[model samples]
Target: MGHVTFFGVVTFVFRHSAGCTGNAISSPHRCILVPSFEIKGKNSMPKMYRTKLAAMVKNFPRYASANQPPNGEIRSYIESAGHTCELRDAGEFQSPADVVNLVSEHPKFEAALAIHLFKAGRLLMDIEIPFGVIFGGTDINEDVKVEQKRVVMEQVLLKARFAVAFTDKLKEEAELFLVSQSSKIYVQPQGIQTDVTEKFCWTEFLRSSGVRTEHVDELRVFLLVCGLRRVKDPLYLVEVFSKWHCENLLNVLVIIGPKIDPVLTAEVETVVKRTAGVFLAQERCQQELHAAMKRCFAVVNSSVSEGMSAAILEAMDLGVPVLARNIPGNAAVVQHEVTGLLYSSPQEFVRQSQRLLSDHELRERVVRNGKLYVEEHHGVKQERETYQRLVDTLH
Candidate 1:
């Protein structure tokens, strides 16, 4: 794939046969000149700069932390393109001094990128090195609600040379809130891949959860995957889901993810203790989580805010039908009644779950369409190429 590159931008010449031998790319729009490693320019041979990047990213623990996985994957693309990347946890940057300390520590780093706009994107402010911003969910969806934070976010945007949003909807949100950044912001949907443990025992997993009723073979499991936090809204569907489970012995609801917040974890723990068929499973690795998704009836998302959800995309790629909260982020990925079901409230979720249970043809159609959507949009090759293009800008 050939990418359009700017005249001064040191980028990959993707068009091999287009006489892009040297790194200098010629096009009306900017071109991604470097398909293979080569360089050229009209004035003179382009100067080769440092390949090291200081990538400050958010990382959550235990299981399926959204930020860390994509951070790792995209950097892998950057590294494969011959860039040395240092992935620092963005959470550690409490103030501007922390960022200055990081830059001082890595004297050879040519550039830096902050993964989440609100969390670490502010670090880009007052830095001399060229930098970019990657918008995470809460940064735009939640943080922009505050006046002080919005002012700081605007500063971060003014300083950023480039930015990446996980979805077009997210890009729109950023542009709407901050204004005049649409050109620099690129819409890159996440690449999808899932490796399930073939030997994983669904029965064993169920038994361990301790929320399954008898005749487990006949039960339908719905997975709600997210790090336990207020934004994730882990408790959103609990009351209705518990009621639905009690009304039918063949249904169960399992909440699984790392406990990101101790306070929220306690609240969920208390609810699951008394709620029948509502189990709280410990967060599993990506492989194990995929195995659960494969064996489950459907996956659910009830987030108050989202950037691009890896779990939702992973579930679709795995051929698991999804029931997501009707939000811009989820809606951008999931087409209601086509790719997956979308419910506005808990009652709607119960009704929709029942539809997924009773309507055999609908299930098959949704599953098929969801899988096709993933294949078309989110693939390993697509992401590798996108990141390769993105990293080239840092040059």
Candidate 2:
């Protein structure tokens, strides 16, 4: 793919025999040409530009902590492109010399890709590697606001051969910091395994979470699946539900995800202890989570910030309508009043939740639309093709 800058708008020229063209018209932008291409073969994989590749991650467990939709998906795609992909835990490296030594041990690796630029825990300035930097949510969204973290991130962005973000929003946000190097930013959506089936045992979830099956039938449950971190705002629903529970409503709110932050975990624990309707459980396996979402009335996302929410997407895929924070990331997935409702305040959320619970027709409509939206937009096939295009350009 070749990119051309015309009057400040960046247009991509895709290589194909039967070329297609389109435009992205935004405010301060018009007549921006986007060329498309006809794929030549059915099994077309990107030509590998580098023979060997290394992936540097922060904490192996933390990097793989929350469901790594894009990272895991792209790793498979990269490997399929005929490059040797090796994983490195930068958490083991204490200093710049340690990073250099780790890279030195893998001399055969021609290029490296840092998954989380800042969290990789290596002084990249002193490490010599032909590497590209992939910015996670923290690097561009949170770290960039801090002067020191921004400086380090800026160096990584400036020195990297290319950069990757999970969404176009993140790509545009990346331009604010690394405006001159905008050409290197690629838009790749995370991929999910689409072979979802409703054949899982709900009893397994009950046993794993220590909640008896009797309690399941006693409450109308709403599940919020996300890591217990401050950014996720897991307690937002807890506070609202606590108030609602006093009304003698037969409803329960289950918050399930890995406890990432100890402080936030304690806060969630306190809320769970005090709140009658709220239940906190350890993160369940993916299949179990899917089954849980299938059984629930609706899914909720209360993230203060997000790139693209995999939890919300998975819920939509399972034909569950979502009630999400009225923010960019959630809005990108949930079309307000169509697929789901968005709220900025606790009052608005409670109102929406009550409405969704009471109105079966509205709930069915949203669920139908959300299912269609996910199938069309966030399907695994679409993501795989997008990655193929991105990797094709690497050569």
Candidate 3:
């Protein structure tokens, strides 16, 4: 997309042509003109400018341990747009001043992107480069409710050239605090692509996770993938799930993800060890994890909050049904009983799960609908185009 500049403000010029060759930028309000420059070299190679991505990174063991898979996917999309990105741990910085110092030290970077308002976005405020904040689940769902955090977050939002929310509901929540900049906030769901290991062995994976050999033939695994964190509520249905398994002799709940919180990891270990039909699988890369997810009966999300879960979308893309908590985030994506099942309480969760398992027609219908939803709304190509346009607009 062609961008125009007026006194250092970036404004995109929209064109109407069948063969338009640039990105189509979308915003909640009118585009502003800003100082703009070319991001290409004489030889036609896309000019490379460093882009810093600030986010949490402590517990994950996969690529760029501090950033989650969604961040990784975003990074890849940014690179595809011809930019170099460096991930800085938002959790490691002690204060906003520290974040400013870090960005100032990297003079080559043209812009910045921060994930989550309180931890990531707060630090990047007052920095020289034009920065945007991508709202994480807690940013709108919990942190905005805190007076102290809400104050800092509002400041960040005002300073930011733009802000991103994964859903319209999340954008509305952010607008409740950032009333003035509601026009700068855009709703864009995370994109997803599911790929599994070529040589995955379902029987071996089941055996390794402690499923009984005799029961493997009839085992109906319900995979719960999340880091061992309090917000995830990974063990929410463990006790009841174990009881159901004992009675049914086929149901099992397997929890898998990185050990993000040490204290929660210990708690999960203790609870999972004592609970029957509940196994804690080791953390694996996204590809391997998706492989395991495909071998299961369904995927369960018990998170207290979510910023448009990549895992849930991936499950849908992989043709797996989802059973998620009835929170605003999940509810926004899942059309309860059509795309997936949504539960408001533990008892409701068990009842819904039972219904999902017993009714094959319901399961197939939900999975089919969920797959269609993911393809229509969360396609990777759409996400890449959106980010490319957003980045292109940065001064």
Give the number of the best model, judged by lDDT.
Answer: 1
Report how far off residue 305 is in candidate 3 (Å). Answer: 1.2
Cα shift from native, residue 45, model 2 (Å): 5.0
Give me the overall lDDT of model 2. 0.58
TM-score of each: 0.85, 0.79, 0.83
Model 3 global lDDT (CA atoms, 0 to 1): 0.65
How much lDDT does each candidate structure score? 0.68, 0.58, 0.65
* TM-score (C-alpha) between model 3 and the true structure: 0.83
TM-score of 1: 0.85
For candidate 1, lDDT tens digit of each residue in 93-177? 5666665555544123446666667667665575565676777777788788898889888888878778878888888888889
Least lDDT summed over 10 consecutive residues: which range in candidate 3?
34-43
Models, CA RMSD each = 8.4, 10.8, 8.7
Candidate 2 on 1-395: residue-level lDDT in tens? 11110000011111111121222111010011110100001335533232344454432322213323344454454554444445544444466575455444412333455655565422445655455555556556766788787777777677766666777877777788643578877776665553344676665665555444466565666778777777788888677677887684566778887766788889888868767767776665566677788888778888887767777777777888899999877777778889888999977988998999789998998999988887776666666666445434433
Off by over 4 Å in 3: 1-69
- Candidate order (TM-score): 1, 3, 2
Instruction: Return the candidate ranking by lDDT, descending.
Output: 1, 3, 2
